[model samples]
Target: MFRSIITGSGAYIPTEIQSNPDFFTQPFYSNGLLLPSSSHDIVSKFKQITGIEQRRYVSQDLTAGDIGAIAARNAISDSGINPEEIDQLIVAHNFGNVAAGAIQSKAVPSLASSIKHQLGIRNPACVAYDVLFGCPGWLQGIIQADAFFKAGIANKALVIGTETLSRVSDRYDRDSMIFSDGAGAVVLEYKDTVSTDRGILSASVQTHALEENGYISMGSSDFPDSDPQVQYIKMKGRKVYEYALLNVPAAMKDCLDKSGVPIQNLKKIFIHQANEKMDEAIVQRFYQLYDLPAPVDIMPMSIHWLGNSSVATIPTLIDLVKQGQMPEHKLEEGDVILLASVGAGMNINAVCYRY
Candidate 1:
C-alpha cells in the first residue's frame, strides 16, 4: 500500500499585529460594548483567560486566496517539485477570499483553484478543491489527500489551510480580539516505506450535526446601523469551551487508540489555535485518558504569539516547527505527531502520522 509522506510545508502570517489594548482603544459606535469589566482590567483578564497576546491582519490589498497562494508557492518550492507534478490541491478554510479591507467573504471559485492558477499549474488532470470542515478543514484536506494516494489517484498533493477572520470578525465584539489572518500549506508525496509505523498511520473526523445552532456562527451582527444584515462571526464562548473540553480530548484518545500510538510515544501534538486554556485542558485530559501525566512540552502552541487563525492554526504551527522556528518541539524520521482541531459546525477531527 502506498503511504503519504509530508515532504514540504510553508506558512504565511499577515504583518499587522493587534494586541488586546489595541481592541480596547478602537472607537466604538455602540453603547453596550462587550467590555462589562473595568477597562484597566480587561486586558489582564483576557490574558489570564485566553492566553492570546496578539494577532495579525492583512493589509488592504491581500486576500485569503492571495496569502494561501503565497504559502502554496513556498510549499511547492520547498518540496523541490514542479507545480505540474502536484496531483491534487485541497484548501481548508472558514471564509473564502476576503479582500484586505473588505468586510465580506466570498468563495465564488475555490481557493485551491485560485492557488493552482497562481502557481501557474497547467495540468487539467490535477484535482483541486476546498474543504470546509471548520478548523478541522486542513487536517481533513490532508486526510483526503492520503486517501488519494492510497487509491492510486495521485502521487503527490498540496494541502493548505487559510483564513482571514479579520474580515468576518465583529470589531466591537470581544471575540474579534481572538481572530487573525494567515495561511499554511504542505506537500505530500506517495512513498513506499518499509516501516508500517511511519507516515500517516490513522485518522478520524467527527461532526456534531446539531452544533451549528449555538456553538459558533458567522453571519449578520445585531448592532443597529451596521451594514444592513452584514454578517460577522459570533460564538457562544461558554458553550464552545465546554463542548471542546468535553469532546475534543475524547476524539484525540480515540484516534490515538485506533492508531495504536501510545500516549508516551507521541512526540508532539498540534491542536487548533483556538484558545490556550481550552487546548491546555484538552491536552491534559488527553494524557489522562492514557493514565499519564500531561507533559508541558508535548504540545507546542502559537496561540499566544499568533492568536487563532482557525484552520490555518495547525498547518502554520507544523510549518513553523518543521522550519526550526519552534525549538521547543522537533520532528525526526521516527517521531509521531498528532494533528487535531475542533471548531464551527461542531466539527472535530484528528490525524496520527509518523514523521
Candidate 2:
C-alpha cells in the first residue's frame, strides 16, 4: 500500500493582531439594539471563554488567496522542492478571491495559477483545484493527495487551507467572536519506498446530521435574499458544541483503531482548534467515557490565538511544529500522531500519521 508523506509545511498569519478592543470599537455593531459592550468587557469575556490572547486578521484589501499563496510558496521552499516539480495544487477554502458567479467558476484554479506565475513555475503538468468542506476540507485534501500519489497519478502535490472568515463574519453577532483569518499549506511527495521517518498511517471520515441548520451560512445564492445580514455567518453555538463534543473523540478512536494502534500509544493529539472549553470538555469526557488514560499530549489551542481558521488549524499546527514552538512531545520514529476535526455539514474526520 502506498502511504502519503508530509514533506513540508508552512503557515501565514497576518501581522495585524486584532484585540477585543478593536472589535468593540468598530461601527459595524452600532445599529444593533444591544449596545456594543466596552472593550475591557469584551476582552475579559473572550479571554475567560476561549483562552486566546489575540488573533491575526488580514488588512482591508487582502484576500484569502493572497494568504494561501504565501503559505504555499513557503511550504514548497521548505520541502526543498522546486515549484516546477509540483504536479498538483489543491486548495481547501470556504472563501476565495472571486464571488461565486452564475456559471460554475471556482477561484482555486485562478489562485493556483497566480501562485505558479509568481513563483515562475511554468510546468505543463501543473493542475489546480479547490475543495469546500468547511473545517474538514484540509483533512479531505490530505486523503485525496494520498490517494493520488498512491495511484501514481501525481508525484508531488500541495494542499492548502486558507480562510478569510472575517469576510463572512457577522460583526454584530457574539458567535463571531471565535473566528479569525489565516492560511496554512503542506507539501506532499510520493516515494516508492516507505521509511519509518515520516508519513500518514491511516485515515477515516464520517458525517452525521448534515441537515442545513441556520447555524451554518450557505452562500447568498442558496437564500436569494438582498438583505446583507443573511449573507453573514450565523450559528446555533450550543447545538454545534453538542455535536463537536460528542463526535470528535469518537472519530479519533475510530482512526486509531483502523490504524491498529491504541489511543494511549499516540505521541501527540491535534484536534480542531474550535473552542477552548469544548476542547477541555472533550478531553475530560474521553477519559471518563472510554476508561482510557487522559490525553496528556495536546497541541496548543489555536482558536484563542489564531481563531478558527476553518480548515487551516492542523496545517498551522504543523508550521508551529517546524518552528520549534511546540516542543517535541516524544514523537519518535514509529510513534503515532492523531489529527481530528469537525466542521459544518456536521462532518467529522480523523487521521493517524506515524513519524
The numbered model that scores best in lDDT is 1
State the lDDT of candidate 1 residue by residue for 1-355, as single tens digits. Answer: 5578888999998999888777556533333444456544666676788899889988878888999999998888888998888899999998899875666567878888988888889999888999988888899999899998888889989999998888888776666778889999999999887765468888888889774455888655545456756778888888999898889999988888888877788899999999899999999988888788888788889999899999899999999999999887787889988899999889899999988
Instruction: Return the clash pairs for model 2, or none.
Output: none
Among these predictions, the greatest TM-score belongs to 1
- Which ten contiguous residues of candidate 1 have the minimum total lDDT? 26-35
* Model 1, runs deviating above 4 Å: 27-34, 195-197, 211-213, 222-224
Count steric clashes of candidate 2. 0
| Positional deviation of residue 34's Cα in model 1 after best superposition, in angstroms | 5.8
- Model 2, TM vs. native: 0.86
